[model samples]
Target chain A: MISLKRTMLFIPGNNPSMLMNSIVFGSDCVIFDLEDAVSEKQKDAARILVRNGLKTLDFENTEVFVRINDISTKYWKNDLEEVMKGKINSILLPKTESPKSVKEAEKYIEELEKKYNIEKQITIMPLLETALGIENAFQIAKSSERIEGLFLGAEDLTADLGAKRTKEGKEILYSRSRVVTAAKAAKILAIDTPFTDVDDDEGLVKDTIFAKEIGFDGKASISPRHVDIINKIFMPSKEEIIYAHKVIDAIEKAEEEGKGVVSLEGKMIDAPIVNRARKVLLVLNKSRGVM
Target chain B: MKIKNIAIVGSLESNDVMITIEPLENKLEIIIESIVYDQFNEEIKKAVQDVCDELEVKQAKIKVNDRGALECTIKARMEAAIIRGKGEIL
Candidate 1:
């Protein structure tokens, strides 16, 4: 199942109401945050809450990911102890600096799967937030087979770069490109960070367009209000879907005629164009829950 | 360990339950107030009972104000209140 990650909404682990209703918000993935969103005092409670939610709540059609504390923190092991006990789609590791960190996290995940007797494997989504992480993104993405995606944490990346955050997002351009390039090279999804300005719908659209232009698979969202916008922007448009169908049909006809080259709407189509159209159709099919 | 004073945990949110546990001398007393009490009252009581049974709690007064919380949440809150009432942290 190609998990469409058009919008990944974060729900605070301790917020029971939000956790229970996370699926109805229309986000493709709902991240139950046990890291930054939770305070030290409620860590245990939040873990328990999230585990219970995962065990009982039916998150129909929404992929569930749990963001555990970083490896540097003591809370991570305990977080895993609770998080691994439940059925989840993936684990998002924060502050992933090196490929070694990914490998270590995979090892821990394996141990937890054994301890909890969870038959299925849980994929990892390493968040590249630091300068070192950006530099080593490719290796980190390839470090573990369990890693299905890489997320660019712009907020923490900017902080690590010692640069002032801006709405223009020019400061982290190089880092974002590196993450996208790495994810592409490893054939994994590249998720962009959340746009902080929740009220600016136009700005969100513009930012999502920029991310899409730069080859991002999708973008994370903090508010449920942005889920529809993000999903709409990232998904293939109706015209594009029509074009994709034409492209595939043209290619199939060409193959039947023993032709090596194909033309669609008077423009020549090559391998790359055909592949891109196929991918668009695949994404479109996934968005409609056909795949 | 015996519970000391009254302790409350969890919330009154849409899918949460606020539970208060107080120490008692002899019998185990449980009072439940829920919007869906008639439909899920027995399940809610069983959840609290499971938690007490696990903790080996013999005597306590458990009050549950539920808002459609699941069985795991009810058990978690009951355990949290019981632990807090004992002046300890897990």
Candidate 2:
């Protein structure tokens, strides 16, 4: 099933406690951060610590991904090699400039995959940070078979553009739309950039709803505190599930009568509509105990 | 018509806390539920798995209210509740 990951929680890989705590933080998934969170001297230590952490306990089905250093850094290759030896769900490639970077990283990942005989296919999330990256988001998403989704890296992007950051995210509107477009074009999830304000639940919820309305699959969250808001926005409501079931019921009845199309409450629902409706049901079923 | 092990369950919904206890074969099984599961439309069984460990538990019932609990907190609360109910050392 294709799940829309709405909130990818960031956990500093160097922090053992956070890593352990995130095993059940209740987000759609988590990205163990080795790039921005760890200092230069601590990179090696973070890697060792993270590797040990993965082996220590089960993350209890939370999708584990690591955002490694950019291709321009020395850590990129070694990160790939070490992560190859560790157990993780996915890899997030930082500073993705173009499809070429994806291809380059995929080569190492593929080599590592074969070397380890890892059974499951590893996923890649490409972070679009540079203007060149934004320009080629579409191509980058298309470049790798492992590329699963696209995330808007606003901090690095603002630095790259030499633009002042704002709380409203208006400065990155063009990039946000572009990232969503590229993700859609490639048929992958569009994840919004994280809300930097840690204490403002109101702002977080507001931004999350905005992202969801703008067709993002999920938003990146800097803190665990924001997971509930993001999760709520992404999941279909109980009313929505009820309606989805009603739609499915009507479709079933129509099929029984050998009808090609059906109208429910005066709105016609076709194949695509029913498919999306079914996805809502799946999400509802997964989160049954949460509320 | 005979009495066996009894399981009592209740919840006090806090902003971030929920507790559940299920009595298994012998040891007390306890679980601290996460509100995050409420948003997910699927099975609560996943949440159950999140809190369970290799610890022995039987004849358990859990109750809890939370103020935003983490995974470790959830599991720890469950374990603590079970031990408290079991008349065992904490």
Candidate 3:
């Protein structure tokens, strides 16, 4: 239900200061990183910190998500257990290769929801990291109902392809296209990978616009610095919001006047079109300055 | 003393406590929006009492820019701000 076309910041799960400051950073969604972002020795400590942070902090409008280690690792089970016990909204499953992986993760999440007495279902964002993950993307997208979105881990995908990642991401274009196509086929949102170069806000903005144009709903960020630019590029402009309001008002007025259809900017509008207009307004109202 | 007097006023009326803390008129001054003020009354009260009790502080006035924060989140920010203010004073 969340579009999240804007920036999603990745906060190291173990860093208390970063996590504490995350809510203030203004990202549309905040991903508490527990995967390659942290070292093995500190995984448990990170989990504790993230759990305590989740327990202690108020993330408000910022959605809280966790990136868990792949099930291939020994730490995956414990990671899932700790994540379930906390107040996390979703779990980002890394290196997702097949639908079975999603189903497996969903079962664990279901168990956690029951164990914790949580009312809402904790959703999953399966990250396609490897070539196989990309190849089997369709299955992974269908693996579970808890899966509301799919993510790209471009660096890992590049590694899997035996190619180097560049600013243009040309080497991995095929895989990226495949991932997007699969996500579209599954009717899921395609979340783009983060730009490793933290200081290059221009690069981040370019890529964000590119991804959005290419059908990605959002782009992930390793550093918070990339957030503002990415957010600006993807956020529905103020003009768009005002236009949405105008369209909604006109449609309602026309309906009240017993008109069959209405036109906006020389385009026809119907019932379904009204719903679309409402969604834009809803997003604007929901995000406001936060976006 | 009740050991601590911590209070988180919604960004809207959060200043009520802050205005009362001022020495000349015994008040604190802070600005906040109205919507956050209305929705967060309970959490504000509980957070203030808890902060006052937990941190062993006396009197506080907090202002927040709530873009629809959760109850737990409001409490967390209150605790964090109180602790931060305490840390600064000490």
Candidate 4:
């Protein structure tokens, strides 16, 4: 089963306090950001600190990811070399503008996997932060088999588009839709950009709900305080769970009766509806530790 | 390895250890000042020594200001400080 990624929290790579306590918060994934979070001078220190943390710290079930610098920078190769020395689940490649960049990173990762004798494949999540990235989202998603998700980075995207970002996010609506559509087409997860205003709980709720409505599998969070809210929004509701159970029961009954069709609450249950119901139950079961 | 210059890494924050490395002409010296010095002084010294051994440092003055950082953290800071002091790119 694919792991749930309802909330991916960003922790500064150099902050030891945050790295040690990363799993204390209930985020499904924690990203050690070596890109924008750390200064250029401290990049080496942060890289070593994060690598050692990954080597020694026990994060249990929380998925660990490292946000390496963009491939255009001189630090990206070094970042990958250091971080790959330890255990990590994925690499969040920032400012991914083309399929070539994805392939470049993938080639290096392949070499590292062989060098380190890493048994598990380290996946890549492309951050579509630039206008070109969003424009070529589908191509980028389809570029590599290791691309697990397409992450929308609205802040830089808006800056690149020369548009002013607002609370309601009218400026990023098109970019978000494009990214989600591309990710779905590629059969990968679609992650929403983080709500930057950490203090505005109400805004966060609205933003997350909108993201869910538009078919986002998860959302990135800068602060730990936002994890619970994002998780709640992405999780199937109680009513949805009950309905899913009912749908399953109806399908089983129809199968026992040798009926060709199934219906729940006077509505015909087609294959699509049944599949949706099964997905809901699957998520519910996974969340409840019934996996 | 020779310590070519003075280099510092890490911070004095909670759960972090600040390591400073400088060139020394004669002998290797290590000084540790941690909040939990009474409990972890020897362990911290061992962590620093292990990193020095890994980096093959023969002459240097190492100072560690530990805010209760873990063994792995101390080693990382020490390695980074040594590399920087050697004027090497990481």
Candidate maximizing lDDT: 4
Quote model 4's iRMS: 0.6
Compute the lDDT of residue B78 as modeled in candidate 3. 49
TM-score of 1: 0.87
Fnat of candidate 4, please? 0.81
How do all models score by TM-score? Answer: 0.87, 0.70, 0.70, 0.92
Using Cα atoms, each model's DockQ against the true complex is 0.52, 0.02, 0.04, 0.86
Per-residue lDDT of A1-291 in model 2, one digit per residue for the tens? 466476799998666567767857788788989899988865654665566556655876577898888889888877777666767988999999888888888888888899989888888999998889999989998997788899999998998998887878888889999999999899788999999989988888888888888888888988888888888889987787888999989999998999997999999997667877877876676577532
- TM-score for chain A in each prediction: 0.88, 0.90, 0.88, 0.89
**lDDT for residue A102 in candidate 1, whole number 0-100:** 86
lDDT of 3 by residue, B19-39 (tens): 111111233333443345777
Q: Which CAPRI category fits model 3?
A: incorrect
Poorest 10 consecutive residues by lDDT, candidate 1 chain B: B81-90
By TM-score, the best candidate is 4
Q: What share of the true interface contacts does each candidate keep?
A: 0.41, 0.00, 0.03, 0.81
Q: State the lDDT of candidate 2 residue by residue for B20-90, as single tens digits.
A: 45445545333434455465313334333444443544344444444454443344444434443444432
Candidate 2 global TM-score: 0.70
Please give, for residues A74-171, the per-residue lDDT of candidate 3 as tens digits. 88777878667767878899988988888888887788778889898888999998989988988888778788788999988888889988998888
Pick by lDDT: 3 or 4, better one: 4
